[model samples]
Target: MLEGKPICGGVRVARDEPIRYVCADCGHMTTTRTGRCPSCGAWGTLESEASSAPSKRSVAARVVSAVDVRPPRRLSTGIGELDRVLGGGLVPGGVVLIGGQPGIGKSTLLLQAAGRVAGTGASVLYISGEESEAQVALRAARLGVASDRLLLCCGTDLEGALQNLWDVSFVVLDSVQAMRAEGEAGWPGTPNQVRAVAQRVVDAARAGDVPAVLVGHITKDGRLAGPMLLEHMVDAVLTFSGEGYSSYRMLRAVKNRYGSTDELGVFEMREDGLIPVEDKSGLYWNRSDAAVSGVAMTIALEGTTPLAAEIQTLAGPTVFPYPRRTARGIELNRFQLLTAVIEKRCGLPCSGHDLYMNVAGGLSIQDPSADLAACAALASALRDVPLPGGSCWLGEVGLAGEVRPVTRLGVRLREAARLGFSRAVVSSRERNERVEGLEIVAVSHLNQALAAGLSRKEA
Candidate 1:
């Protein structure tokens, strides 16, 4: 019908077939009817478009399925610790998200990852929206990329950068915060803009089967600076957590969709690059024999690896009306809980004292097994007595002052034994191998643990 000619006040036209749809997902159009949009492999979200161009995914899926990907692509991070967290090596088409605080080396880690990927002779396209082309080149110089497989693009437009996906296997978005589409009004990294741009980038990746790694910026509150959907959209979320004060940085896999989330990659930030810390236990336990006050070894787990860390506590008379409580690498409530236990059970005057605790190597020990170390540290400080240098503590301290056992006690015990700790204290029922050259102290209750740790100190 002609425009405005119908008695119903609307023009109408009849067609033999349903109109072709361009999937907002893959941005590809199809006339075929199905619940799933074939262009981008998304479930739905298809609009009108006319295109006869067959999908590259379909064509490659058939022929490439016959070829073995494992034969050609091999992952060698050059950093052994990073390699371990990644589960042997980087798999093709696997998306990884790396997040950190500002100036915390998010870009540096990717540059290092790029060097490692390029080192394996894999072609990598590094798309930088934050930095000028020249700035990226300067960083590359400092990074020292020896492989010729690395490609750099300093363009801010996602559509332009994605056009080169066929030539490269992996894409590194230096940062998703700075990318913007043409004619988009809102600022880059805003909620609406981030969602739109992210969807487009994700669509392009899915359609092209190109594995993309994005560096996401975290807000000042230490949370991801985008819609919560961003975290759900990614395959894995890695947090590069460390203090700016120290050169030691840790690569912890906070979330992994396809692998174990508990894995970790430890690195040391140096003038050259991020050096992987392979033997983390050795680093934390190096001064085990120094007889340092306010320090005690605690065994904990990062993913599956069991390691020992030195927990330090400082106690002194409060100088102000409000007692000071400062904690690092551990939760504040946890320290307060231990203090309450010590005061209620052991009768230590911890309520009026200022308390501070630190986990060595700038690595956070979240496992409850470190509770005993925390209590021992507090006791040592309260008594003004140093904890024995050759002693390491484990076991969770309960409200009623009982030492609760932890899992993988054997691993923690072995680590303590390996580091030459002369004595190890844990819950009575814990599973630990009796190793030579060390004394293992199994305590049934909190009083026993405190007594054993303090008895030697006062004597």
Candidate 2:
């Protein structure tokens, strides 16, 4: 007989039972051991552990009225860009997991935010398991973040860090992988330990009604270095990304429970710390009046923010049988598709020429609206003719080479006009709304757009 009374659906198992295996990479559990995880296909990731029966408790279920539910108020992180990406600000009891490559300024951004929140007369706790107190202090000093209300703790014991959660209004864990729970099996950074640490942090934040941010690491594939379950357990998942050779950094949300994930935050790493960039277009646009071959401008929208970007391409004769196609800041497949479109639809000789493309200012754009600009740049380079000065392209090219209307035409044109652009090439199907100080050149086909935008003068 069991020593303790069994509750409803709660059963005690015998001491001898089959051991279970759990995948360390994807958090998959199975009674049978396996060499690779069926979920994520990662080999040698399954770890053995004892299996335990789950207790099923029966409790009264209450259905609350939707009218009684009120949205939680947000606490500002004192950084406008960060706040924008976070869907306005951090909510009480919300857990945010932000991941990035090493040396991407995750700690610096959080420390600066903590300092700012502490400056507002609210206590903020910063817990670091990866760095020593002195190291963090030295970096904090370098960032000029000195606040009495900002408390610091350095340790891997998650329970010890949560001890101060109730005393603080905001909390930050430098990294979840570096922290461990009291009774968790395996070492820190293991799948089990990561899950345990995240669960503990989530529970503590919910109980204390404080906003918490967890810094996470990214794998070589640019994915968050943990089980998929870690992302689901958090309220928001943000990615801080930037090129190693560039000072610009972009922060965007992959998941947000409280708000929209369309917002983006731009920052520049400076001597003091990460500074928010107000004029994002200036970073990508060269404001030059000189018309050069192989260069075309476009206004790409990052969320609601419109940025003027320059796309440059080069086309030269190749000696090899198969000409090389190289692209940076844009997908190679997309570039190839556009090259094929230009060659077939516009009658451009791209089959024998080596093509190279890049987005200016080290900004990676996924917006399809820049398709027209890319095609125009490629055409201009191949023809050795410079595109018209003060012109912007806004359209999506189809496989048949037809230019399709893009969303937010007026927004893109207005941004172009603001940057002193005089003309914009757009799809003929789009409504011709007159933007102030901007002329719209609508074309139904890529051929028409190329003919209209490219100047007769050769480079």
Q: TM-score for all predictions?
A: 0.77, 0.91
Whole-model lDDT values for every prediction: 0.77, 0.91
- Spell out the clash pairs found in candidate 2: none
Candidate 1: stretches off by over 4 Å:
1-78, 132-134, 182-187, 282-294, 317-326, 347-356, 360-362
- Over 323-391, each residue of candidate 1 has an lDDT whose tens digit, in order, gives 888889889999889889999998888767888888876767788888988998888888888887688
TM-score of 1: 0.77
TM-score of 2: 0.91
Global local distance difference test of model 1 = 0.77
Please provide, for model 2 over 432-456, each residue's C-alpha lDDT reduced to its tens digit, 9 standing for 90 to 100.
Answer: 6899888888899998898787743
Question: Candidate 2, which ten residues in sequence have the lowest lDDT sum?
Answer: 1-10
Best by TM-score: 2
